[model samples]
Target chain A: MGSPAGTGTGTGLINGMMGRNNIFWHECAVGRGDRQRLLKQKGCVVWITGLSGSGKSTLACTLDHELHSRGKLTYVLDGDNLRHGLNRDLGFSAHDRTENIRRVGEVAKLFADAGLICIASLISPYRRDRDSCRAILPDASFIEVFLNMPLEVCESRDPKGLYKLARAGKIKGFTGIDDPYEPPLNCEIEIKQEEGACPSPSAMAGQVVSYLEEKGFLED
Target chain B: MGSPAGTGTGTGLINGMMGRNNIFWHECAVGRGDRQRLLKQKGCVVWITGLSGSGKSTLACTLDHELHSRGKLTYVLDGDNLRHGLNRDLGFSAHDRTENIRRVGEVAKLFADAGLICIASLISPYRRDRDSCRAILPDASFIEVFLNMPLEVCESRDPKGLYKLARAGKIKGFTGIDDPYEPPLNCEIEIKQEEGACPSPSAMAGQVVSYLEEKGFLED
Candidate 1:
C-alpha cells in the first residue's frame, strides 16, 4: 500500500490522536460541565442497596418522581428491569452477578457523565460489589442509600412471596435466606423502621431529596 | 416463611407489585416524556460509521459542540474509547466484536432513554450489527450517518498508523484491509469527499444538525 498521492488528502482530516496502546480518545469540546449547566443540575448516581422487598425499587421510583417534579432530569436503572434488556445475558451465578453489577456501574457512570441524576436500585447483597460501583463514580457523586430494614421485617412483608419460596427451598440463594446480605458500613442515607412502623414511600423519597438538595446536586 | 404475624406487617410496606414471570416492574411516575420536557429536547441516537480513518470521531465531536452551543445536551460514545472501559474483557474475535457492538448499542439506548442526544462513532463495518442497534431505539430516533470516504482516501490517511501495520501483516483482520467493510444501503445521512476534497468538520456536522433540527429531535 504505497499510495502517496491518496495519503496526502488523508493526513488533512483526522483530528483525534492515538493515546497509549493505540487507543484514540476523542477530545470533545462540550463536556460534563457544559451539559450540567444546560440541565441546571449536577450529575450523580444514587445507589440504593437492600434485600428483596426492602423498598429499593419503590424508593428509587419515588425519588425519581420527586426530582422530576422539581424540574430535574433523572433515570432509574433497576436491576430487575435491566435483566429484560442490557443484562439479559447474565445469570444468577456469582461470576455473572458481578459482571451484571460491573456493567450497570459503567452505564450509570455514562448517564452521570451525560448530566442526569441516575438512580440505581438493586438488591446488591454483597458489600464488595456495591463498593466497586461506588469506586467508579466521581467523589461525592455516589450517594449510597441503605434500606436498613431487618430481615424479619422484609421477610414478613414478602412483596413477591420470594421469602416463602426461599424458605420452602423452592428458591435457593435468595438474599436474607440462604444468601447473606452485607449491609453498608458507611452509607450516605439509611431508611429503617421507626417503632416497628416503616416510613411511607413519599417520606422515604423526601429524605433522599433533602440530602441531594443539601449536597448541591439539585443545582448546577 | 409461613409466619402470619410477620406477613401482616410486611404487607403494609410494599408499593410495587409483581408482573408476569414474577418480575417486579417498578412503575415510575417520571417517564421519558417528562424527561424530554425537562430537557426541552427529544432523545435520539446518531450512529456514525465508516472506515478507521474516515473522521467519524471528529464529526461526532463537532456535532456535539454545535448541539451544545444551541443549548442541547449530547454525549459521544467512541468505540475505541469504550474498549478501555466497559468492553475491556472483549478481544478482536468475530463473536467478541459482535458482543462489543451489542453492549454499546444497549448503552446508547440507555443514554437516549435518559433524554440526551447520543453520538456513537465506530467502524461498525457489519450491516447486521448496525441494524440491530436501530431496532432498539424509538421510531425515527436512530439516525445512522454513513461516512462514505473511499478506502483509498482512508488508507492514505492512516491516522492511527493502523493501516501501515496491517499492510505489513502485523495487524490482522483490519477493516478495509483484510476484513470487509460493508457500506450502508439505506443510511439517513451520507458524508463523502466533495470535488476530491473533504468537507470541513463544521460543514459535516451542520448537515447532521440540520437533519436533527428538521426531525424535531432538537426540541421536546
Candidate 2:
C-alpha cells in the first residue's frame, strides 16, 4: 500500500514537483539488462490451435507443467479462462475472435520479452488470424502446433457441449458448424490424433519440448 | 488432439458423445492426483506490494525461483507484464486500480484452488481494495508484505521513469503523485529501504519464505 499522509493538499503538490527532478536523474541508473541476465534463456510463444474438444488446452497445460518441472519458466493462456478476464469483453464472433487472438499474441510477445515461454491454447479457426499472430512475434518465436482433428471427431468428443449446442442452433457461428475452420497449412508441429491412437497429452507436449530443444530453446 | 474422422454428426449425437465421455473418464481414472493432494497445505497469498522503483518484481521472480527449486509449486502475477494482456484494457485510475486488484484476486484464488502458491506484486495503493481481496481468500491466506521506501528514495531510484512523467504531468493518475498511495495498516512483513543500508532483494524474499515455512506453507 502507500502513505496516506504523503497526500496532504500542499505537500502532495510539492512532492509532485520534486518527483519530476528526481526522475530525470534516476533513469540512467536502473535497467532491464540485469533482469535479462538472470533469465538466461530466450523466450517464445507456442500457440496451440484446434477445434473444441481437440485437446489444445490439455496439451498446453501439460507442456507448461513439464517445462515448470524441468526448471524452465513457462505459462499457459487457456481460451475459456482468458475469456473470464483479459478477453472478457470479446464474443465468439469472427471479429471478436480475431481481436482475441491479436490481444493474446501481443501479451505473449511481452511474456517472451520477459524471458518466459508463453503457451496459448485457442480454437483460432482462421488461418489469417493465426498468420497475423505469427507476424507479431519474431521469426521462429511463434511455434504453431495445430491439433488437426476431423469435425466429426470433435463433435463426438464435445467436451463442453459446444458441438451439441451449435448443432441445436443454440450456438450460432460455431467453428466447424455454421462457421469454418481453416486448418494451418504449415504448422511447426501437427498432432494427428487420428493417425494413431491419439498420443497422451504429455506425449503431445513432449513433441513441443522436442521442437524447443531442436531450436536451441531449451538448455541441454 | 482428436480423432481424424468417423462418428455421427447431428441426430446420433448421443452415440458420438460416448467417445468423449470415454476419453475424459479414462483420463480421470488414470490421472495422478498430485495437484489435488497439494492443496491440503496452509493456503494463502503472499501479496508483494511496493513502488515500481523498489525491488518487488525482482524479489517476486527470485522467490518463485527458490520455491520451485524446492518441491513447492508457485505462480507469479507481475504488474507490468500482466497489464500487457489480462489487464490491457484498464488504465491506472482509482476505479480501474480496484478492478485490477479484484481480477488478480480471482485468478490467485484459482491458482490456490489448483494447489499452487500465488505471489502477486503490484503497486496496489488502496487498502480497501487489498482488504477486499483478502476477504475473498481464506483466513490467514493473505500475507501482506509492504516494501516501505521513502518517496524521495523511490523517486531518486525511479527505475521506469514513471515518477518523472508523473511529476511533469505527462502521466495522469500516477500513484504517489496525482493519486495517493495508502500504505498497509498492519502488513505481515515490511521491507525498509534506508539511505545507507538495505537487505538484498533475495534476502528480503527469504524473509517471506521463512514466514511461509514457519506458517507451515512450505515443507520442512
Top DockQ hit: 1
Q: Residue A183 error for model 2, in Å?
A: 1.7
Q: What is the DockQ of candidate 2?
A: 0.12
DockQ (C-alpha based) per candidate is 0.38, 0.12
**Candidate 1 DockQ category?**
acceptable
In candidate 1, how many Å is residue A174 off?
Answer: 0.7
Model 2 misplacement above 4 A = A1-45, A57-76, A85-90, A93-96, A102-119, A132-141, A193-219, B1-45, B51-78, B81-88, B99-119, B132-142, B150-171, B193-206, B216-220
Which regions of candidate 1 fall more than 4 Å away from where they truly are?
A1-21, B1-22
Q: List the residue pairs that clash in candidate 2.
A: A2-B181, A2-B182, A2-B183
Top candidate, metric lDDT: 1
Predictions in order: chain A TM-score = 0.89, 0.82
